[model samples]
Target chain A: MQRAKVVGTLWLSSAIEDIRGFKILILKDLSSSKGGYFLAVDTVQAGVGDEVFTVSGSAARQSEATKNSVSDTAIVAIIDRVNEENI
Target chain B: MQRAKVVGTLWLSSAIEDIRGFKILILKDLSSSKGGYFLAVDTVQAGVGDEVFTVSGSAARQSEATKNSVSDTAIVAIIDRVNEENI
Candidate 1:
């Protein structure tokens, strides 16, 4: 998983029928050399500015919002803190 | 970066005006203990079965296709293999 910040939210009027109850958020991927971001499905009730953990693909499909959704990204956890040990 | 599998592709007819020329693909996150997947932008020309490196957020927005896009995910590289060192 990667550390990310919730940057924004997406409002979809018409999406797949199965994903009607799910919420989607735009996330910034913080694991890259230059850092990056992307839109991801939110499952942990994260808000803008909160750091989060994201899982993608079949794992995303495992969430109720994506039970039948065509989603590829999902927030699996809200990060309280991270510890980086020297390599 | 996390290892992921390209599971599928997304064909959008109308998206943010800035994202018109970008291609979107669905991805599976391979890092979780249970393993998961999600949708990610493709920058490395990866195929459905290819394992790739993905960068999200502002980093995703850094690509030419997403120059003005409202995208949250972007594939950064293609992986030929991975070696798991014992922890």
Candidate 2:
């Protein structure tokens, strides 16, 4: 799992059959120093600036909200804090 | 789909259950000027310096060789030529 922050929402008038009817989220990759962003399906109730952890690959399809879906990535959990001491 | 160049190969002594026997490739993302590097499963017979196009997300699993697999990315085809004028 990796950490990210929700940055925006994406609404597509047309989308692939496997990913229809989903609320797509724009996430800023927090695990990287470059602060890059990518899109993922919102499995949890995440909003802009909310810190969340995500699953990539077919693991994204394992979430209940995205089960059997064709998502490349999914926001699975929201994080309250990170304990830096835990290494 | 996106353009990339094969840079190197990755051999993992330990890997997750879903991708046990596949050879992972290191690719330079040519779609972006920043040229980010990422890993992908090589579906085609690709080599270092070969220009290729890849499928990302669950779609990566749609290839015949990768069907029922759990890859996040896969090199689906090698580019023979680029008609810059057409696209």
Candidate 1 iRMSD in angstroms: 15.1
Tell me how far the alpha carbon of residue B2 in candidate 2 is from the true structure, in angstroms, after superposition.
Answer: 9.2
Candidate 2: segments with Cα more than 4 A from true spot: B1-57, B61-87
Task: Highest TM-score: give the candidate number.
Answer: 2
Among residues 3 or more apart in sequence or in different chains, the pairs in candidate 2 whose N, CA or C atoms overlap within 3 Å are none
For model 1 the local lDDT of residue B79 reads: 85
lDDT of 2 at A80: 85
Residue A5 in model 1: lDDT: 84
* lDDT winner: 2
DockQ of candidate model 2? 0.08
